[model samples]
Target: MSAPCDNQTGGPERPSFVTDDELERALRDAFARRVATPRPLAADPAGLAVRRARRVGRRRTLTGLALAGVATALVTTGVAQLGAPAGRDGTPIVVLGDPRGSSPSPLPAESTAAAPAAGPVRPELDLIVGSWLYTNGGERWELTGVSTVERAQRVPDRGGWLLTSAVTAAGRTLWWVPPNGRPPQVLLAGADAIAVAADGRRVAWRDGGEVFAAGAVAGQLLATTRAAAPAGAVPVGFAGDTVLIRQPGRGGFRVWHSPTEDRLGTVNRDVLNVYGVRPDGLVVGQVSAGTPRRPCLALLDPARELAPVRTGCDPELATDGRGDVSADGRWLLVNGARNAALLVDLDALGSGGSGQSAGPALTGVVTWTRAGAALHVDAAGALVRVRPEEVTAGEQPFSSPVDGVAPGDRPVVVADSRP
Candidate 1:
């Protein structure tokens, strides 16, 4: 849970939450306090140095022990089998840390898991209507097939989706559901997290505490390249050819060029969590900085050390990393206070206008369609399309129900859905 908003900053304060590192430290200190007796092993300077090194190693071992205990507790309670819950408004929630505490070692490059048997492909598709994939009560649903995929992202050019299995003791399987509908091919196994480029031409994933990148060509992954990353790093999204890796429990992110494996440096110190990246390279995230530490939705320039290009501050607004920017980077869908979903106009916000005061908040997860309309799930789990003019005029934007799709399913539209 987030801390109370500070009036001095005119926005929400940075969430005061505990981190894994802090928890480990507390556990170590408590264990030390119970040591009952101290052995005198450091009378000489050299002996003291050896003792200090041993203590450090012991702390490291204790961290691993603590994480193992956490994993055991989760499995015992069946929490590990549960998927992340959607927000009250239907926005998907983003959790930062791996349940196992640290990333698993990376699998061999040739170690691809066997692909599942392919289903029959549809004869034709309406690209204009687009496609969306989401999981409903443990079933992964797409227009052409259904499976047990826990998370999915659209591969626009490939006409399919990239899928990841639910967390397991071994790790998650990364699969590619082809447009031709042959079957889903396994791209990699034992992956911790995955991120695809905006164009669907490139892909990146984290495994074994390292970040790997590869080109997505003709429904197949090209040769893979690996780069070392900081501890607890996970690939969040891509900025052009650069991969943006978020450091769990830390306020900043690392920008690394995929092809060259160059560490561009860290960014977004004031931004707590990133939602999405704009086409022009501006990062959309929750910023909590400036005098008095105001929290708000901000556009941060990655090249400028994450300086705010524009800020939309609202005292009542709160985000759990459950929002996204439109294809044109003009509209933003974010979950507002009281579970209200808001459609924010970036152009207006840049022109000295306010998003919270400009339009009424609706109830559902709102996303942008290819035709520039707002497609959302209503309270009854129905699909509703809203025109751009209706959003600007503060009028009721419900247009019609989307046909042939089940209700109560979250929809993921392509990001660049500009007219």
Candidate 2:
């Protein structure tokens, strides 16, 4: 797709965007280090370099032992399936980690399995190939036919999903691929910062700093309320009815919620990144290394109900761009340097965060769904699913990961069949 901001006479248009190739390498190196590095046996290491090398070799053996232990202890004893019940308000209830050994309950038996029949057969994975969006399945539809896909999301409503994207040419346009086997339809133009609600019925985006909401299936304009966001605030997501936005950092980073459009509070400027803000007002982001502080993952409950929790960050932790948090708000899929993912359990925030061996490393956007699935595009451009339990296991299984179409097919959106 031709970029709009290019200089006709000389230089290249648009700043450098990282390619999928670079991301794959980074993910491989990061995962290898996290899976194998051993804790120092001695309090002091005056001359144990050789022993450390040997310890590294033992990591593969240790991984096998760890997996065996998990089968015996975690699987047999029934460690909870990593979930929490919903709060009184319908948002998932988030409790602080016990640190004393108690853990949250496992997901209900039904959720631990594939999502109910009401959910989609599979979640769709989308990739940006110039301006067009192709589906690995389905009669491939080129969203714009003539424009580029700037951003896209699968509508969350289980009744059926609408694949929404911002198609850009001279100006940005909004469009949706309906579930009824119809061709892609244009919703509007000149929109940016588009986000779809969990139910996939509502779509929101920014136009000249004004945020607008519209019906994805009904084809109706919902609202165009003026936002009080600070200069340069961009609409990022929708948690239930609340719209989450990120503001550029001046001293401390800030995330503002709309309708109310109030700042989601943070403890300090050291909290330099915003991965996501939950419908319940929980903010997950990174705390940059600063004076008297080491880099860490910070979970800020803006309601002031819980103490702000910060766990020391891994030197390899990658907190670039934004990431996908699970529907229950307990699991988050993070992409580190080189397209590697760090799977974080929100309930374990006070403890050091956990890592996942996201097989083959993700090369594109990673997203989570209410169906308990984590989806992403791998380095080969193939769409894949990595189950939560598989991720928590922390080792590459001997078996192949969940299979899907390979790279170069178009994008797919996994959403429920439209009623």
Per-prediction TM-score to the true structure, in the order listed: 0.57, 0.54
Candidate 2 runs further than 4 Å off: 1-147, 150-152, 156-171, 213-217, 228-231, 249-257, 260-271, 277-281, 289-295, 302-316, 337-339, 369-371, 397-419
lDDT of 1 by residue, 1-419 (tens): 85665766456454558675665565566656756669643344443555676677888788789868867875675522223222223212222222223423332322133322332122111211123332221222333233334455556643666665556665666666555433455565556777777667777877664677777654455555667777778887777777877877855666777677545466556767666677788887777864676657788776666678887664345546666677778877666765655677776664555554223344433455556665555555345555556767776555334443443433333233122
Relative to the true structure, candidate 1 reaches a TM of 0.57
Task: Give the residue spans of candidate 1 off by over 4 A.
Answer: 1-146, 156-159, 165-170, 262-264, 314-316, 350-352, 356-367, 376-381, 384-386, 397-419
lDDT of each: 0.56, 0.49
- The Cα RMSD in angstroms, rounded to one decimal, for candidate 2 relative to the true structure is 30.5
lDDT of 2 at 300: 63
